[model samples]
Target: MTPAAVNDADIHNKLRKELAQSRVLLVDRHPEARNFLRMTLSAVGITSVRNAGTAHEALRQARNARFDVILADYLLDHGRDGQQLFEELRQQQLIPLASVFMIVTGERAYRRVVSVAELAPDDYLIKPFTADQLQSRLLRAMYKKKHFAEIYGHLEDDAFVDALAALESLLARSSEFALDGLRLKGEILNALGRYDEASEVYREVLAARVAPWARMGLALALRGRGELAEALVEAQALTEDFPEYLAAYDLTADLHERTGDLTAAQETLLAASGRSPDNATRQRQVGHLAVRNKDLAVAEKAFGKALDRLRGSSLRQLDDYTNLARVRIDKGDIAGARSVAADLRREFRGGKGSEAAESADVAELAALVVDSLAAGRTGDAEAAKNALNAALARHDSLANRRSTAVSQHLAVDLAHACLAQGEEARAQALLRRAAAEHHDDEGMIDRIRGVFARAGKEHLGEAMLTQVSDEIVDLNNKGVLAARSGDLDAAISMLSQAAERVANVQFLVNAAKAIFTKMNRDGWDEALAERAQGYVRRAQAKDAASPRVVSARELCQRVAKKYGVQLESAAKWKKGTDSEAE
Candidate 1:
């Protein structure tokens, strides 16, 4: 045999040995298919196998056990496909980047299945394939996974610098996975805010071939570098060329929204939702945009679909129920609104512990707003006022414990309630709080403005938003200026106060950065380091992937090393999961 053939034979022999010890999860809606796959794996001498009949079960299995490979049918039950499941698993970090995920689909869906941009599967199998074909594809995918193992490890640790080094090492050898290494390099550069370098990387790939992911990466790099117009143009071209690229549509919608064109944003999301109706997150975005654009019909449909799609899934959120009800109330459908409120109560009811009680309290708070709006529509002024007052009393205490998105929605709901009840001062305060907390989020700001417009206070809302923006800028600037002038003590004090007061991501990150700088300059104070760590945690809670958050983290790492202090894992600062970085 030739030398190349001998090398290939050796690799195949090694893969077969590894396959014997690999654990696999097979997800298919049909039991017969699962059995067939299990038999095939057994024939290949791979006896460690698990079966899941739905995406939910697949998620559960993946969460509880670490599998070497996951094979999922494209047509999963409950309106979720294998691609969606893969996206969720990656986004939630339930699956490691080192593992192999393969999609099994029919020939009809082969094109659509392979056209995914944001998160593509390791490999795919068309139906009616032989067991030999399955083994061949699995071995190839496993080989590729092994090739990128080092890079994946660095990414899981959020060590972008180390990841870049690994990528460089891989690329220097001109390996078969050179293009994949370039893709990962671009992603790491973008994540680290090195947008110019990322843009160059993508451009280099684009020059070689018209890869959809490269196009999308280039657009993202441009956007990160503040080249919004160019980014939008590139994204629009990408969507036109590859309409099934749902992530391109999302980027287009985001660009439109950032350009102050809410109507275009809504239309873009609506089109994407039409193409993929079962995407709950996209549906929610469509609903939010439609609500801002005063398209109650579309808002109701989008939110309803989102609620239905996520009903019993672990991904379900209270916002889905509240959003649908809010749309119903806006449409003057009091009965519909009350029906949704009843459903919310039922969905979150009857649990036994403190966690359950807290969930019930939040559900009740949401239901109260829905009921109040319904009451107002029915001309029950007294009942509306009473319920509104009750929700207002509990809003602050409850909102603080929720995610930023959830908290903002609750604030907007309460503000709408206040406006409807002629409590202008209360409404203003709530709106201001929302604006301050989410000053950088255009969607929430637009939603806040929508509430004022509904109450015929658009001009006042604009003024309040401007005031909030100025206040945040002024507060942030004081510390930034103090630091620039070498007044680290004052900068730390002011920035820390700003973070505590607003809890905005910018303020929190800046506060932590200032504290770290001070500690690095002078001797490390344990109390100050602890305080800085708290700010970093708060910033991560707000936006873990923010460039500012990353910078703060790097600074903290540097200072900790300088002081020879062992810090906690950066993964602990992530919002929900303590798993590795995405």
Candidate 2:
């Protein structure tokens, strides 16, 4: 006896009427599964359905078409899985907010991963479901997305006030969407820096039901409102109740750090790591915290774990290798540092060539210099120094004239290498340059000061760095005065010239803003647009993790749009579920 096919004529007619023009994509490794999905879709009057057997093929199909509905299996062929594919698509901005992404999985364990994800699918369905069940989920998802379009547009435009108003209207108009509207309203309020209002909205949600996300939002809102004790209690309770909630762990650790409980913060992260050991981002955060605490053992262990997780993935970065090597050198384990440096060299050697190739080569040579100095291999250190100089010189010639992609961390590495080679004057000059470029950044200044102390020249480095810092600060102050005087062009010129002299991210961001202001007043100029983007790109490369840099990046996108310049990755942040809205 064969299994009977699902035949629900009334359900098909209803779904078809509701989703008349919908385009669907089915991703499954099994041909039988694809055939079954296609038959189900066809029965529901959805004839435009594409099929892909692998994640890569599915990605290709998605890129080629704007799919209204994407039904992906939890497990795909080969190493790739549906979750990874979904993340890649979102990262690349290949998927739109209005589209529905469904996780169709037979495995019950898939729910665990979905529950804690920062971004999850719009809907999920367990396998072994009837066609009627599939139609019901799809219709609900489509209805929500369609109804939320007006609020989404305002939110995308950064019009939080307008978005809130629209959400209020939606709630008043349809009780069916009250929870979604309230959730979105809370997120918009949070983004607008209205923590008090956001907290109220979140409390309203909690009154309706105990949602993990709402609880997280309430904690974040409390923190934003400067109610640390309250936020701490909520986050603590959340972690105890839902240990799988990664955000709760992160929030708990951050609050502990803010309150000066470093030990507690470390323990919280360690506990979370025990639960989800494969999360590279959490491992990196743990390593950074441990390093700040001067706990080399914990830092080393966390970084090693991160390296293992990042291995063979595109997410692997030079910082992971450099950070681990730095820790080893601090621990006086020259052999360990040498091994890490060798691994770094191998990691970049086979990579596809990019403009940053020269920078990477120079960084590798600088790392070798550290390892050589630690081992007392004077000749090897000298060779590495020469190679590093050659690499820098090549980088100078190859770099774009309009771009100042200065990496302060790389400069610190070179300064350390120069000090190792007994070139105190050159080392001092390099460190002074970095300090001058990042004068307003107390954290970067402290890091530079620490490096100087490691070289036994703390007093001398401090005096030189202070002098340069004062000079740069004065120059920036003059630029600000010019901007305040309504001379946008003059402000841009002053700040941009200072940026060229110092390769400062602050100067570049200011100049970019001034240029944008000028363009908005005096009409768009292609030259200014290009120059602005160059500054944004340079700032991004120098300090990608900084919130200031991220804000600058967002402003650059707005400026690009104003000037009709096409930009990539212009989306503000990750967008998928309610969590991303916050």
Question: Against the true structure, whose lDDT is highest?
Answer: 1
Give candidate 2's error at residue 319 in angstroms: 2.2
Off by over 4 Å in 1: 1-17, 112-119, 396-406, 519-534, 556-582
Report every candidate's CA lDDT. Answer: 0.84, 0.71
476-533 in candidate 2: lDDT tens per residue? 8988899889988789989889877877778877887777777777888888877876
How large an RMSD does model 2 have? 6.9
Off by over 4 Å in 2: 1-94, 104-120, 154-165, 222-230, 258-261, 350-373, 376-407, 432-446, 460-485, 497-509, 533-569, 572-582
Worst 10 residues of 1 by lDDT: 573-582
Candidate 1 on 203-304: residue-level lDDT in tens? 999899878989999999999989999999999998888887778899999999999898999999888877778888888899988887889999999999
* Clashing residue pairs, backbone N/CA/C < 3 A, model 2: none
Tell me each candidate's TM-score.
0.90, 0.75
- Candidate 2's displacement at residue 228, Å, is 4.8
TM-score of 1: 0.90
